[model samples]
Structures are given as C-alpha cells and as structure tokens.
Target: MACKVQKRVSLRRRLHILRFLTNSNYNKLKVALENVKREYENLIATRRDYIRLLDNNVNDNKDVKIVKISEGTFMVKVTCEKGGGKLVAILEAFEEICVNVEEAKVSCENEFSMEAIIVSEDQSLDVTYVTEVILKAIEK
Candidate 1:
C-alpha cells in the first residue's frame, strides 16, 4: 500500500513539473510573438509613409516639357520641387548653350515652374541640341 502511494506521489510531481515547463514555454512564445507583431507594425507604417510620398508625386522634380515654336525658337517648361540652383542654372543655360533668351517667367515657391521662350542666336542653334542643353540645366 505504501509503495502504491509513493508511485502515485511521484507521478503527480512529474505531471506538475511538465505543466510548469509547458507554461513557461507558452509565455516565452507569447512574448516572441508580441515582438514580431510590433516589428511588423513598424515596417507597415514606414511603407505607408513611403507610398504616400510616392503618391504625392514628390519625385516629379526636374521634369521638363518642351515644344518647338519655330525652326530656331523653342518653348521650354521646367518644374522643380525645391532649390533656387535650378532657376539660376536655367538663366545661365542660354549663355552656356549660346542661345538668345526671348522671354522667361519664373515663380519661386514649393513647386517652382519656369517657362522660357529660347531662340537661336546664330545659324548654329539646332533645335534638338539647344533643347537638350536647356533640359540639362533644369536638372541643376
């Protein structure tokens, strides 16, 4: 009878130990799961912000729209998100490219827009070549 009681007590102690270990493992898994969840949330928030900036067309800086007004005259339109360097470079683009500035209008603000009517100073002014030079200056 005493042997039976001892065996039962031993089995009960073993079962209690298994339950404790299981609970400890469960708690550790819960904490790890929580950490993963937090990291996932942070990643999602950062991605959302990036997508928002992309959607706003913030990457549309230094975009150019040009139209050939005549054989030696061309209309150049440039858009910039920030900085006055591009604006200053554009004024110098005509001199650098050896072209005449017929007319130019610039508005300095959040999204600056510059519209210019550029003409060739001499017969050397090629429409395609001058357009490329102006576009490159808009990048600066």
Candidate 2:
C-alpha cells in the first residue's frame, strides 16, 4: 500500500510541474506578442508623420507630385494644361540636375502628362527641389 501511495505522489508532482511549465510558456508568449504589437504601432505612427511632412512641402503645387521611393530613387508626375516641347524641356532639366530617367510614360496629345521614375546620384535632392526644377521646365 505504501508503494502505491508513493507512486501516486510522484505522478501528482509531475502533473504539477507540467502545468507550471505550460503557464510559464504561455506568459512568455503573451509578452512577446505584446511587444510585437507595440513595435508595429510605432512603425505605423512614424510612417504617418513622414507622409504628413511630405504633404506639407508639396501641397502648394497641384500640377506636380514628387515622391521619394527609396534612397536614390524618386517618382515624379507632372500635368500641364498645354503640350508642346515641354517634354524635351523637362528631360533637359533632369539632365541638369544629374538625374536619370529609369522609366517613363508620357502623353502629350492634348495636355501634358508624364509619370517618370527618376534616379539621382545626389543624396541631397528632395521633393521640393525636384518640384521646382520641373515647374521651371514646364514654364519654359
């Protein structure tokens, strides 16, 4: 009888240990999940702030939109009320700024509309500067 009782005690102890381990692992996973959620929220907030800054800088001009796609790449879109040699002028301006046109889609049938992927070696180039240069090209 004593042997049987000792065996029961051992089994009970093992069950308790398993339950404790399971609860510990559950707590750890919960904490990790919370940390990931916090990090995601922070990343989203940072992106929102960056977009707001870009909007403020480019809001004055409705004819042009310039967005930085990556470190040295920009996406530029321009729409003009008139179409002529504006496309050539814009290309020249891009050359003057040392920017290369990686890809572009342009329509100069009735009005001028262009979407271009531009890459630049100059790290200091920003949306405002590119916008100004394109605007000047459109005027000329």
* Per-prediction TM-score to the true structure, in the order listed: 0.59, 0.54
What residue runs in model 1 are displaced by over 4 Å at the alpha carbon?
Answer: 1-36, 39-60
Indicate the TM-score of model 1: 0.59
Error of 2 at 12 (Å): 99
Q: In order, what lDDT does every prediction score?
A: 0.80, 0.89
For residues 37-140, write the lDDT of model 2, one tens digit per residue.
Answer: 99999999999999999776544333999999998799999987654588899999999999999999998675678999999999888999999999988887
Cα-based RMSD of the predictions, in order? 5.7, 14.5
Stretches of candidate 2 above 4 Å error? 1-62
Candidate 2 lDDT score relative to the true structure: 0.89
